[model samples]
Target chain A: MNLVQISLATGFLLILLGLYGALTNRDILRMIVSFTIADTGVNVVLVAVGYLPGREAPILDTIPVAEAASRITDPVPQALVLTAIVIGLGVTALMLAYAYRLFRARGSLDISEFTELKW
Target chain B: MNFTTRKAIPLVLLLLLGSVFYALFAGYTPDETLNRSASYYASQTVQDTGAQNVVTAIIVTYRGLDTLGEVTVLFLTAAIVGLVLAHSKAPKGRSGSGFLPSGELLTTGTRMLVPVILLFGAYVFLNGHLTPGGGFQGGAIVASAMLLMLLSDSAERFSHRLISRIESSAGLTYVILGLLGMLFAGGFLDNRILPLGSFGSILSAGAIPLIYALIGLKVGAEFSSILTSLEATEDSQ
Candidate 1:
């Protein structure tokens, strides 16, 4: 298949791996890393969606005046990826910070020990 | 029965996910822009936003609202983190033993690379609208630089006041600029407030480059502060 298909398959595999890690790994930090892998997969797929096999960057000087729109690659996905990147950064930072706080309070990053919230 | 049920969740999830993927691929029609509009966006970007980058146009103009929402989400996260990690009293000092040295090589390398990393981060942040990198990525890189310092030095306390002031002011400025756009331009967060200079010029794209720069500053400060706060509380506990 094409690169996009390969990326999709890889993203799914990553999600599966991450799911296994999140469920089986006891450490909060490890879980977070797995989640990041999952997120990276999604981001990769999203970026891949906009990938034009042969298209050039949509700069003005590259294409003729009349054919400018037709020759350039789709930029909307890049925009989406930009937003996703920011959101992912914010969320990952928060998650890691929370994990740190948890470590401080309990002296362990093992998530199973955090039963107070569950109860 | 126990073994059967234990296996059911994954089996069911796999089937459901597989079906969904099948349907998605079957129905996955690319946008009309898959055939067109890349160039349209590119040319219009040059003509309207005065930026040569169509990605910048889509980010700063076509999808500016989404960018605003992303910023808001970050603001809310900062507030939540602050609330959760807030301590009424000063941190109690760590009674535990000193940090174990991982390796002299890592420590020295991190010390040497901090300045270069910081410079690269600034460069990326400043040239966001013109380049592949942007505020968020650059800000995070800068934060990583600080993280290395924290991991290696562990003795230098970051200035909370400097970080907080930068964070709050940057967040406030974003909203105020959005309001200014509402007052003067097409709508909220309009990049059209500033003059659209010549295409590919750094001064072009109205307020986009400035906005992204501010975002970079805010994100870098906020992330550094978060790390410092975490380290402080961890040291005390």
Candidate 2:
């Protein structure tokens, strides 16, 4: 209905799509891409949950100090989202490196092809 | 399991999860007013950190240690990626297959754009305490510039020595600044080491800008290192 609800729904949908993709994709790279989509969904949900109906961003440049307490959205979730996004990038990079090594070792990009370690 | 069944299971699960999420989201309502801590941060950010950006203030001042840890995690990930891929030999004859020589237009454009992107990244991190952008955003921008260069010129190599030096010195300075804060200010990673100058100005926010600059440089270097390592493997192919 509102922007927050729309964004929240979109975020959840993205997470579900990402989960499905990650679970079903046979390619390791595709799975990593799905995970990244999930990370983005988590970030979107976080920022959306912290959103107030018509409040401005947590910046005080435009808003006067007297009205700031009532005008700005929550800063904590935004901060957390920022941190999470960076950490997610790092994890993705690590996963990509692992994929590269796996491909180098086995000459295959498919996760199903790398079943030598499977019991 | 059959291929159709395997695909159908995840789709069904996704649909179920999506419905639950939609229900949760549809029923939820955001609070009309700021919560207690949010109110405090909104009111006190200017007085405490002298940062016009409340999000930046919370990130760099109220939760500086968390930021430090995040940077360290990024640094560690870059290092681990390098370590993990160190022994892998790139396959021969694949480089020319997957990559082509850069066009003259791209080469010239990249040469022109690299410096501008680097300067913009510096500006973003430097003005972080006053604006919406910060170290992480700026560093990522810088790394993107490096990525552009790497993509355009397959032969060009980033200097590993320079990257490591920048990373180590920035990290060292960040630690020292945190220690300085602990000794001189209220506690560890406090931003009050220097005078909290004029509010809404670049010079304000005490040590926040400095710390963020260090973080930007460190993060940029780390990302560049990761790119370079990945690029090195590509070159050997």
Candidate 3:
């Protein structure tokens, strides 16, 4: 279909793929990678939702001031996505640190191997 | 439950979820016109913030507090990573003897590229108000430069004190700028503390570029610290 619809569909598919990987992968690092994929999907979907059919970016560089309001896509979602991507990076870094610590303590990277807390 | 059944269940659930998402998205249509807030930003960004980029205006001006919180979160994560890996033993060499020297090509290439990458990062953050790139993107680029250095030489060590000083000073400057906004402008983190220069110019947008530059430096330092800690752990092992 249109570019927006295509991007939306791809985003959803990516989320599903990431979810499946995260759920099935036994390795902590693999799961973290899967979560990052999911995060990317969420960002894509957010930006896609804010897109209008053929509107330009929300920049006033080329577009005249009079026509900008009608020509620009939603800026709010773009801003939100920008913040989300950075936060996702932070979260991913934290998870990786946790993985490193777990590996250091137990010498294993498998999530299933860390069941000592489960009573 | 059987192993095969357990595996199949998640797959089936994923399929179901995907179908649900597809159905929800299939009938949706994007509006051709901007909504209320989007239109407001599009029309007023230049006049209000003097930023050619509306998204930048919305990010640094309209949602400054969120950005501050985001920077704080990144800083916290970096701190936590350092703390978590603080006690790890140093990394032995590739053969478990001592630190191994990197290849000549890697070392030479890193030396050549690191300056260029750092310059690019500075450019991106400095022109944030006039372009699509911003503090976070530039900071990530700067971190990649550190990653390149780390990869090139295993024995090379970043000055932890220097990195922390840079991080703290940038963070403090950011806070003071926010306070300045509160005292001189509309509210916290306002980009109107200084004069909004000519639109589409680099010097315009008041404190936006300044704030973004500070943010980029702080974020870069934080990421560098994280990389250093991780690399330190590798050395201790």
Candidate 4:
């Protein structure tokens, strides 16, 4: 009914799709992409939690006179989100690079075939 | 097959376990009410740092140590990329062919967007002290611009030597500035060396913008070099 509930529903659906893709897809690259999608869904939920109705950015100049950032989106959440984005990017890049190498070495993108690592 | 299910189960279980762990243990908030907006650090960063951006506040001030670690990671990645690319021997004294994928619009669009991206990236880095963008974000943007150039105009080549030099020197400068901060200023990585000019000015931020600039150049060069090496490897193969 409310905006948060709608966003929560969408995010939950996205998480389910990501989980399905990560499971059903055989390609390692697709699995990684699915992982990213799931990560993004979680981030969306975190950001939604910070949303405050009718509150401006917490910057002093942006806030109205005598009216503080009541129920405004939390800056802490925003900052945390930014850091999470960076870490996600780093991890994604690393995964892709490794996937590329795996494809080159094994001539296949499927994770099921990567049993050479097991002793 | 059974093998596929086995592989899927580990990854699925890992993700589930990690989420459960996070839900259980990661609920600690700061004992102090450290609101990121309109806080002491923000004021200090604006007044004393001369940075036009507050995101630069957290980047260059409150979480500066984290920034240092990030740069170190970038530096390490660049080094490893260089090592990997170098080991794959092709031919000496040549950067090999620069064959771009066809369709003129991509190249044209790249040429058009490259400057805009560079300009915006510069703006982001310069205004990081007062705005939402900071060194890392802007630096990545600049790198993206370089990647665009690589992708669009395959003929536009970047030199490995130049790339290596930029990466090393910029990283070196970051550490040295940090040391200088420790020796002379309040502590390590302090922006107390340069005169914090009038707030909101380009020249403001004790040395914040300069640091961001170094980071931008370093990231741009490092990433471009990595892309270049990959292209070359693909060509050779």
Every model's DockQ, to 2 decimals?
Answer: 0.47, 0.84, 0.83, 0.22
lDDT string, candidate 3, B95-123, tens digits: 22224666899888988999999999999
The model with the greater DockQ, 2 or 4, is 2
**TM values, all candidates:** 0.81, 0.93, 0.93, 0.76
Which lDDT tens digits does candidate 2 get at residues B140-231?
99998988877785424566788889999999999998899889999888999999988888898899999889999999999888886776
Candidates 1 and 2 compared by TM-score, better number: 2
- Docking class of predicted structure 4: incorrect
Which candidate would rank higher by DockQ, 1 or 4?
1
After superposition, the stretches of candidate 1 with alpha carbons farther than 4 Å from their true spots are A23-28, A58-66, A97-119, B1-4, B26-32, B35-40, B87-113, B154-157, B235-237
In model 2, pairs of residues that clash are none
> Which candidate wins on DockQ?
2
> Candidate 1: global Cα-lDDT?
0.71
Model with the higher DockQ, candidate 1 or 2: 2
- Any residue pairs clashing in model 4, and if so which? B49-B205, B50-B204, B50-B205, B52-B130, B53-B129, B53-B130, B53-B131, B54-B129, B54-B130, B54-B131
Better of 1 and 3 by lDDT: 3
Q: Write the per-residue lDDT of candidate 1 for residues B116-185, one digit (tens) a residue.
A: 9999998887777776766787888888887887777542554568777888898789878878888988
By lDDT, the best candidate is 2
TM-score of chain B of 3: 0.90
Q: Over 4 Å off in model 3, which ranges? A: B89-100, B154-157, B235-237
RMSD of each: 3.8, 2.5, 2.4, 4.8
The C-alpha stretches of model 2 lying farther than 4 A from their native spots are B1-5, B88-98, B154-157, B235-237
- Give the lDDT ranking, best first: 2, 3, 1, 4
